[model samples]
Target: MKKVVITGIGTVNSIAKNCEEFVKGLKDMKIGIDKITQFDTTDHKVKIAAEIKDFDPQKYLDKKTAKRYDRFLQLAIAASDEAIKDSGLENDGEWKENAAVIIGSGIGGFKTLYHEFHVMEKKGPKFVSPFLIPMMIADMASGVVSIKHQLKGPNFTTVSACASAVHSIISSVMLIKSGEVDVAITGGSEAVIDPMPIAAFANMTALSQRNDEPQKASRPFDKERDGFVMGEGAGVLVLESEEHAKARGAKIYGYIAGYGMTGDAYHISQTDPEGTGAARAIKNALDMAKIDPSEVDLINCHATSTPVGDKSEVRAIRNVFGKNATNPIMQSTKTLIGHSLGAAGAVELIASILESQNEFAHGMPNLDNPDEEMKDLNIPKETKNQRIDVVLKNSFGFGGHNASLIFVRD
Candidate 1:
């Protein structure tokens, strides 16, 4: 298997409009989650989210193109463009033909779906725009990106709930390992912070109702946390075989050491109580990396701040590393960015890579009272400067999809 390295990354999230801004957001612990401004939330229980401030599609897409594509696709294009620009492979001969893209999304275009459905109900299906189908489908992000950039390799989107983006990364790694492609652009995009998802998550009791203090609402590992706050954003990464990157003199951030994917075969929306599946995924990734559990310096957890979800993830950590897993200094990115649904995996993965590269680890914010089950773990209560050698990024989604990615410092 060839060594896969992350050569470039681009992101558009509630915290920052681009990857450089995103790094500042993580370092400063600037919370992007606040009151939802995209729609009226007067009747909704959950009124907060991590939304991109003053989102302007014109910055990334033309006005004519923007009218046809949904917000999610626009975000994908912006992030992908940034990544592609950063990679600097545009001039490399035959690269576009061999490059691949495998971005993911949990809900394709929620805004388009709900709005078009209403249009159909009121104005009839015949009046629906011809672009409705392309904008509403889940896989269009990768498709449109490949077409725009003239990439002809494997192109598709993974839709495994929150694990979608990590799964996409794993797919890219496998493709590179198999000599299927030399380079791949992959990550995730999600912009579903609207009435339907909010109402649905609220009905499922999966959203935070701490509307009074939206910034502090997404308090992962805090005992007082009720549920996860919805967030919207997009994240994209440029990956390539290490040999190819070195030959082209590409800037390398970190190496994709290994990846693991698993399924709980449990409930549709509930995680496996024992967390065996999540633990299995972590162990598998470590095994592939050929690194001992003790060698891992940090754990980027998928702690969504929900009662059962947080505890289950902690138990999974215990299963693999035992009671003293805190030696790795576990932390959750959701504490600041909230959960970005399908984009959560890629967004949090970016946090992990940046923290490792910057040699810092964050404490669980707003963790005044820790959950009893997670008390044994050594979660930081404040940001600290430390050496991070290897980091594990975890993403466990609804319907039992679990993915763990290992990145080692270059």
Candidate 2:
């Protein structure tokens, strides 16, 4: 069987703008949620979010090229640049013709799209920006990454709401394992911190109204939690087959041993209360990895903090591991970075890889009181240092999408 491994990782998130800071932010338990500054929130009930700070696209592309892409595309390009540099791929023989780029986004170029629609409505199509169409498409991230990096393999976007990024990782692994591509620039990116999405989600009551305490708003397994706090950023990973990585002398962060994807088929916007689908997904991943539940020492859970979402995930964990489930160090990075939506899985995957390397798991903040349903799990409210061998990252998204990826410390 072909083995897949992560050769490099890059990120741009609310708490950190690069890979090093991202890992440190997670370890230090830094929360990035805050009042919205991208636009005024006076008239909005939900005024808080986790926005990327001090981002300048000039770092990735020249001004002329920057203007052609939107913020989401800019983030994708920057992260991809970092990942490629980190991999030191230039030293390897030419890879432009066989490498692939597979990036995902839940809402791509939302800011540009929203702005363009208003421009067209007010000033007509003649006045609308010509770059709107290309900048607003979700697949542009993958396309731009491929074009910029000169990678000529499979390139496309996978959209499954919050599960989008992780889905890309799974798909990338398959492509490499099947002898389709030797290298893949894969992950997710988003920049929908604008007013349009905030209002739409707020009206759906999918946002927390903790305008007074933004940092405490994304309380994932706590009874005090109301809803998720929106966040924006990009996470890009360089995945290569073990043979290719070893041949090129690339640094191996960890091994992508197995993955499982399943849909609830129950609801478009709601999770099955019984956690039937989530459990099956978890079981499928474990089976693929050929390990029992007890082997996994940590789980980066998909606790989005939504009322229904949190409970369903916990139930799924419990159903899969039963009493032994309490042994793993399970927690949510969302408690610190809010929900990055599509980019979340890749971001949290970074944390998982870091924990696998550092042999420690970060604690969950604002979780002073774990909900009764989640109290049984071994979610340390404080950071704990332990030798970790196997870690699983769960990403359950809207539309009943559930994806689980298993990584073994290698």
Candidate 3:
């Protein structure tokens, strides 16, 4: 079996549009959630999201290409471009022939769907653009990215809600381990911070209603937490087999030690209160890595600020680590950038990689009062400088999907 390692990473999110900015954003604990500006939210119950500011796709793509793709696809291409370039794989090479593209998106091209719906209602179905079908599908994120990069190997999209991106990463790792592909551009992108999604999530009571306090709306693990703040962004990583990367003199950021995925099977949209499946996912990842729970130095939590989800994740951690549950410093990047749905796992994993590389763990400032279950947990509210060598990241989605990954820095 081949060892899979991460060679490059890129991101475009509310707090940072690139990896450099992301590092600084994490260091400063920047809050990116605020009043929504993508549409008129005067009549909505939820009006806040972590919207990317000054996002000009033209900076990363050609004008025509940028204009033709939906926001979700644009973000995916931008981040993939950065990751490929960062990996020094932009130039022509044999790797391109067998490289895979497995980008994931929970809700892809949602903006296009929302727009085309109004186009048909106002005008006629014939008036809709011919590109509507190709542009609005969730799988297009992977298709368009493969086309842009000319990657010819396996290509597809994962659509497991919030777990979508992590599943993609896991799939990529398996492909590499099985000698199916030498390298893969895998992650997730999301751009559904539109009025329709906001209204839908709000109606379902899955969004924060603290419109007046946008910055403090994403208070994960806190007693006063409402719900997750919607965010829009992309996180892409370039992964290659250890031998393939080393042969080309590539720079390796870290190795994907192990990964695990499971289903709750308890509820359609809610995690099991006892966190049975989630604990299994974490344990499986640790077991695959051949590392004990105490070996983990940092935990990038999947706590999306939702009351049930936050409590459930803590319980899962306690269930797995037992007495050492408080040993690893756990944190949630969502507290700063909100939840980007399918992109949350990839984005949070990128945050974990940066923290491990920089030797610091970022905290959640919005956690003013942690709940009783969180009292014994080592969730710092302020960034702490410490040597971070091993990281365990978790992501759970609607539909009871749960995924966990372990990254080890050598």
Candidate 4:
């Protein structure tokens, strides 16, 4: 198999709009959750979300193009542009064909759907915008990114709920390892902060109701934790075969050592109670990476702060890591940035890379005192300085989809 390495990374989250800023925010333990501002949440039970504030799509894209795409696509385009430019491939004409794009989204253009429904109800079906269908499809993100960068090779979108982004990254690596592509831009984007989706999630009891304390709302792995705070943004990385990267003198950040994916046939909206499916995915990823559980320096957990979900993931981690799991410094960035859903895996992957690169460990937030049921783990209280070699990122979504990615220092 061809060796694949990460040459560039780009991210836009509730905390920051680029990788450097995002990493700095992570180190500072900045929390981005706040009352929703994108839509009226007066009648909703869940009113808080980590929204991408002060974002103007016209700044990155023309008004005409911006109007045609949804906020999710806009985020993807912005992140992809940054990744491509950071990869130093914008002017390199020779390898354009070898470049591809793979992106994922759990809920694509949800705002668009809501708006069109409102239009059909208030005015008429004929009043719906012509771009409605194209804007609402999940695959449009991949299409828009490919068209923006003139990437003509393999391109598609993955839709495994929260595992969507990890799946996309894994697929991209497979393409490069197969020698079908030399480089690929892969990640996920999501923007479902509209009233309809918010109300829907609230009705299903999947979101936090801490409207008064938005900052302290998403306390993952904590006894007081209620539910996840919704977040919107994108995370993207540039992947290239090691040989191709060396030939072009690309700066390497890390290596995509391994990836594992699994699905539980048990439920559509809940995880397996025993965590068997999630545990299997983590073990498979470790086996593929040829690394022992003791070698994992950090784990960016998929704890979404839900009552049952967070505990289930804790059990899964313990099952896979065994004794080494006792003091494994685990942190959930979701506490700071809320849950970006599909884009979460990519965002958390960036956090894992930063932790490995800087050797900075973070403690669980809002949980000044952890519960005894929260497992015996060394959850970081503040960002600590330490050397890290390997990191594992986990993303488990609705419908029992679980994905894990292993990253090693270059």
Measured by lDDT, the strongest candidate is 3
Whole-model alpha-carbon lDDT for candidate 3: 0.93
All models, RMSD in angstroms: 1.2, 1.1, 0.8, 1.1
lDDT of 4: 0.89
Q: Give lDDT tens digits, candidate 3, residues 110-226.
A: 899899999999999999978888888998888988898899999999999999999999999999999999999999999999989999999999999999999999999999998
- For 27-114, candidate 1 gives per-residue lDDT tens digits of 7888888899989999998899888888898887789998899989988998898888888876665889889999999999889989
- The sequence of per-residue lDDT tens digits that candidate 2 reaches over residues 1-410 is 68999988888888888878877888899999988889988898899999888899998899999998999999998888888888788555487789889999998999999998999999898999989989999999999998887888899999999999999999999999999998999999988988878998889888899899999999889998899999988889999999988986778887888899999999888889888898988989999999789899999998888888889998898898887788889989999888888999998898888778888899987897788988878888888899888988999888999999899888
Of the pair 1 and 3, which is ahead by TM-score?
3
Whole-model Cα lDDT of every candidate shown, in order:
0.88, 0.89, 0.93, 0.89
Prediction 2 TM-score vs. true? 0.98
TM-score of 4: 0.98
Worst-scoring 10-residue span by lDDT in model 3? 60-69
| Residue-wise C-alpha lDDT for candidate 4, range 360-399, written one tens digit per residue | 9766668776756665787877887878788888999888
